[model samples]
Target: MSGHSKWHNIQAKKGKIDAKRGKIFTKLGKEIAVAVKTGGANPDGNSKLRDCIAKAKAANMPMDTITKAIKKGSGDMEGVTYEEIMYEGYGPAGVAMLVNVLTDNRNRSASDVRCLFDRNGGNLGANGCVSWMFQRKGQIVIQRQDGMDEDELMMKVLELGAEDFAAEEEVFVITTSQEDFSSVREALEKENFEFESAELTMIPDNTVSLSMEDAERVQKLVDKIEDNDDVQNVWHNAEFPEDFEE
Candidate 1:
């Protein structure tokens, strides 16, 4: 579950996610289920499951729902089996895109996604076609409240050895290497910090800049793909215009 988050304030992003909470929960629940089936239900001993739980919580998924998903994954409860798949593609402006999906029927998903691309000025490519252009990184976002001091927060982030930091107008974004993600998140928790969202995300090595019209077209294509029940995320390298309004 990822997005071009650096382009928008985390708070506003949260609002958009909230609007689609049901679909997000379904996707996250599938992730939790698959993580458990693969590694076991114990988050402590299963880092993948642990990370999935953290992401589920960040999306404001209900605690009871989270517990049920764990149980379903562990086979204590009945649930449909789902498999994870990622589709690579290019959007309207040659913007590299990755669509993450979890489904019980691979053929149905592949056909549906290909049709979406065909109709939306995109081309679904073979696996690994665009994955190389992205890097997986850990990201933690904290909203800037009235009492938060940017310098003090940045100092803490630096001391924690995050790879990068950005203090946006309404939030603080801390990024770490993949291996350091869990430790950094734990450290922040010890200091009683709350995150708007914390998880591993794909960041593009470089972004594609297009005219405003093309950028909007790409965004529209992304939205259309995301509206599908089986699509978990749509990650793209479109560099949104600074003047763009949410």
Candidate 2:
């Protein structure tokens, strides 16, 4: 696994959960609404909605909140229309960064995002600038359990159409082509596999090795961006030292 992945796993394990839960729910709600608006309110008939519901459930979002979001998105209730946007940039040490956001006000989101980058020793760039340094793919993570057989799990994921699989110290990561993501996830779900995370993400082609200082700076930038209401996800290419303190 890359340093970015390791850092992500560590964050998942140790980040402040209670303080961030509300923000997480807000983001998931937006995703659910967008998914319903684009596809439909039915998860069975709408893969995007299905994925959103899965994500919401993983976050432990209440069923009523999920239902309300779907209703609002399907025009059964009042809600603001949101537009999806992607911002590309370079963080400290020339680390390529990608920000994904869904917002009702594009100008506000753009300004907020640009300000975050600027204040954090980075700058937002043109759309294709840093995007070219990354590839779109589906990533799924499952925690490593005591009773699990690594080889058997790898075979299962491969059989279900995953492109690659890696067994990290604390988790199993599976990669799939963007088009294959939903099917692969569905297959895994049918077999009763639980996930730490399952999402379509931007994977960097290569990473920039950063010193401790640079890594801290880049991570702070990432945290600020992620804390924004409209920002749903942030992808970066910085590779910190394995033993670097969080």
Please list the C-alpha lDDT of all candidates, in the order they appear: 0.82, 0.82
The residue-by-residue lDDT of candidate 1 on 61-92, one tens digit each, is 89999999999889853556777899998889
Query: Candidate 2 lDDT, tens digit per residue, 1-246?
Result: 232255353344235334588788888888998898888889989998988887676566789999998987788535677889999999988999999999889999999999999999999999899998888888777878789998898888888898888778778888898899999998988888887778787887788889989988988898899889999988888878776665
RMSD of 2: 2.3
The prediction achieving the highest TM-score against the true structure is: 2
* TM-score on alpha carbons, each prediction: 0.90, 0.91
For candidate 2, the lDDT comes to 0.82
| Clashes by residue pair, model 2 | none
